[model samples]
Target: MSNLLSTPYLDRYTVNLTKKIAQNPDNYRAYEREPVTNRVLVSLLKKIQNSPLLVGEAGVGKTAIVEDLARQLLASNDKLLANKSIIQISLANLMQTSDGESFAYKFQQILNELMANKDTMIAFIDEIHQIVGTGADNQGSALDAGNIIKPALSRDDLQIIGATTTKEFHQYIAQDGALMRRFDLVEVPELSFNQTANILKKVSSQLGGEITVSQEVQDQIMTLSQRYITDRFFPEKAIMLLDGAISQAKLNQRLAVTTEDVADIIHADYHVPKYVINQTTDERLANLSQRIKERIIGQDHPLDKLTMKIINREAGLTDSSKPASFLFLGPTGVGKTETAKQLGILLFGEETNFIRFDMSEFKFASSSFERFKDKLTTEVRHTPYAVLLLDEIEKADPEVMDLLLQVLDDGRLTDAYGRVVNFKDLIIIMTTNSGAKAIQNHHAKSDYIKNDQKRQENFEEQLEIALQGDGYRPEFLARIGAMIIFDVLTLADIEKIVALKLKTLDEKAREQGFHIIFEPSEVLQYLPSFEYGYEYVEGQKVVSSSIAKYIADVGYRPSRGVRPIDDTIDVYIGDPVAQAIIAKRAGQLEDFNAFIFRALGNPPSLTSPYGEWQTVISRTKEGNYEVI
Candidate 1:
């Protein structure tokens, strides 16, 4: 671990600087051609003549150079009075506050305090250009702030060090000759990757950790992150990442940091900013779809088709003048509505992007079409790139559909006032349990009816099917690019989906800094219990109330979802007596060993009419009995 950091004075901030080597024997690091720059800066410091400007690239140590010089000036010069003062002030903090005050107000008081302490003045201002219009009451050129600074610049004992970017310096300070004439300016160029690498290596040594991060790892981190590293931000983050990797390695009981480890740490902890956020909408949409798949299992075909449409609509953001809309139709408890909510979260950085209006909430307004456009206008402006979800689209009066024709076709709307509302960047998702009974019958229906009464019952079923059949308008269907039919979640998908939820619970356990690993059978037990209601057709969903009911009954009925084979799960299963039967020592043993695939129900029964298996486990006279 002590590969290079153990050398004396190298870990500490201050050391003698006049000689290339430290005044005392100690291993140290110097920047690329930075010594020459340091010497130039040191030379400027000694000239107590005009105002001195110390400009440099961020993180290249503009502030450090001044600190080093101040240390040398006081320590080296016997004539240098203890009364001489060197103060550091951050200019950016002043601008960020409201009711801004001038930096000049404290100027004289600061100087007096420094003189009382017997310190000569060296006031270093970081980001000095922020005060271009320094005088608060009246707006004036930066010269006014500069002119206020002029008196301090004229003093015989005073020495000023101002740091700023070359571009900003030229625009604000350099333009005013009166301000420019008082101080001498210096340029600080950005360092190459090699130079940056050296500084990070030194920082590792200083922090007392032996981390030999591979050059390739460093290269990727720097390359992916270079643009955001401007003005001192680069070295700080890289060193911290290295430090984190070292800490993680130690905790995981590893000998040294590896390349893969650093990448994982960075991706998890840092959000590397891209230069132009281009095609980001499409990328965001794709990530959203992936996140959904992770949460909702076993609908690959439908998920794929629907995700493609979401991606296509997102791609339209590139040419926002032409935007697309969407409509989702399916049976109750399917994921049609949940998909919209999830997309809003992924795309807009939160769930706020989509404002769902239950079609029934607006059903009354549907009777009066004139008020419709006004309500949509107000909602649209608040959530510009919003997903306007019209739930129960079929329940809406025919009049509402008449107005929807405009929003669906043109990506634009005309309000009652004749004001135009553009929806070129909006995404519309409509969901309903519209054709549930018909969908249910399509998947499972009896064609035979004997008596006239039986024949009448059959007619009602057929009529419901006909309402959503081929006779349904082609224009309505064509307007919606992707209408995913959600079938009742099959046992496999529901099992897999519940497994994902259990995994989430495990993650939350870890985040709370605890250990949790569930036995495979615990969550698998909840799957078949979802089989009672949802009947999948061309459209069905087990996501909403059905899911809520199932979860409330099954997931929470146990202790935080680790339900034992016992009927202790009292809440959601809707069977309290059955719960008492499962926890019986013999019965519980039987249930845990039991395997009930979809069709094999009775012989391997997990639940009796009274309660779950009699008990989870029981001990025999010899020390082992049975698990149900």
Candidate 2:
């Protein structure tokens, strides 16, 4: 035990920098060129009590800067570090021993050794924050490692270089005034794009000799990593992308990394849709509006404005930190939700990427918004690139609306656990019925498309007032790219919706080997006659004039919306046909066409061999369906 105190502790717990550098020269090759290296050296050369504390975010090259300083000290002509050695002391290793001794004893022996060779030694401590409160039974212990080293550092008894993250520096070292004052802090920021590009090139030159990375591929790595890799800081994120691209090339038994190769790696690493990242802007813009229009009928005003915003975003004109956000204002069943779904399909290439939350669900109960907040953050974190539809935004509680401010303003949300969820890659759509009354009033007086420019301006002005009345702040509206007013569906628009819905139903029936056709007039007759100044009734629809007259006498009418068409089709068409098919009343359904519509008789019947007989579907005087 006495001999251990006499012998030096360097052989057991410290790695000699001179020997390590001699054995592996490549480790310091790129380090010398890194910008942080100069700052570290300057900190070390201070006039009094010089020990550089490298502080930065993790993976921003703090430890690497220390190593570069070590390399520089070894290669320099200056006597302070010339022929002198830098050895990294493992604080953890010093705390443990087979020999029975207090942790204070072992800590003192290591310090004594450094003191003996102080002039010729510089000690490096990585994760230097561990020195505080370690090897102590509790906080404020006199025998702790931090207390043992304080006097040595104060008198310049040992030159030490310490590395830790900015968080740890404040958490550990800043607490003790005596220990904190001894070292100068060197802040290492993340490398710039040009610097990161150079590092990637040097890395490829060093280890990726067999696989070539083109200049175009390097630029792509820099852009993609900066944009998509949110959880990590600079150069590290860029380097990871480069490494992944090289691996991808090798996996495919290829030699060179092209732009496509880098893109493929990014897609796999971040799960960004390949088409979204790789498609040319012109091509995407050319087909976007047409494709969205196929599923979203009417509302061409919103569609056109939305198309422009999307094209601008895709072309990289706006700030990338904020997501593309839109507030869809109008009445129910006016293609608001459908526009969001179609947008999801257009951008992400799938309907499953559409995330919808009925904001009304978060309005009533005390814990409902809390539960919804957690769910919303989790879903967006996992599916960062998606269409998030907040339906009935006006129905949500004010507290729930507060949660969206960060998302709408910064394009990021910090969850309860402090993890940042990125929304920059998302398309956020918030639908509301706040402006419905105003829109309905205007549409009843004039054609929705009349003098389109003035109409849109007036609509926007009126909708803005309604939204403000509903408690949305003007700043919240400003953050959104557009507040698109989905137009009220006219009879013609409803007809188009009916056809689209029937087409979808027909496809489903075809899958089951049944051929079905609808008599257009019969379906049209069932559509409620929506006209100017008409009032909407609940649970009752005027399918024919007799019913309309009767309902008018009572001063009630079904509102203007497309949802009734779907419900009417389901009742008058879908239900009766399914019943007939089950009963075998529509004989030999397969390989024979069956017609579904309002019937001529008291009970609705499905007619087979549909086109052979001239069946005209019409409304009787008694407000009933008749086939003539």
Total backbone collisions, model 1: 50
Taking all chains together, the TM-score of candidate 2 against the true structure is 0.78
Per-candidate RMSD vs. true structure?
Answer: 17.1, 8.4
In TM-score terms, which candidate is top? Answer: 2
- Show where candidate 1 strays beyond 4 Å: 1-61, 64-106, 109-123, 127-148, 152-159, 164-195, 198-232, 246-255, 258-302, 305-333, 336-628
Cα lDDT of model 2 by residue, 1-628, tens digit:
1222243567866888767886675676544245567666666666676888888887777666666666666778876666566788888787676767667787788788888877677788899999888788766566677888888888877778888878889988998888889888878887777888778778875656788888888888888898778878777888888888888888888988878778887777777777767865586568788888888888887798898898888788888788898998777888899899988878787777899999988886588767877999899887788899999887888778877876778788778898878888888999988878887777776555655788767777877977898899887778788778777776456656666777687677667655444534444444334222122235453222222112112221126466666666565556655664565544643323344332221111265322221122232333443332
- Per-model TM-score versus the true fold: 0.38, 0.78
Among the numbered candidates, top lDDT falls to 2
The CA lDDT at 201 in model 1 is 61
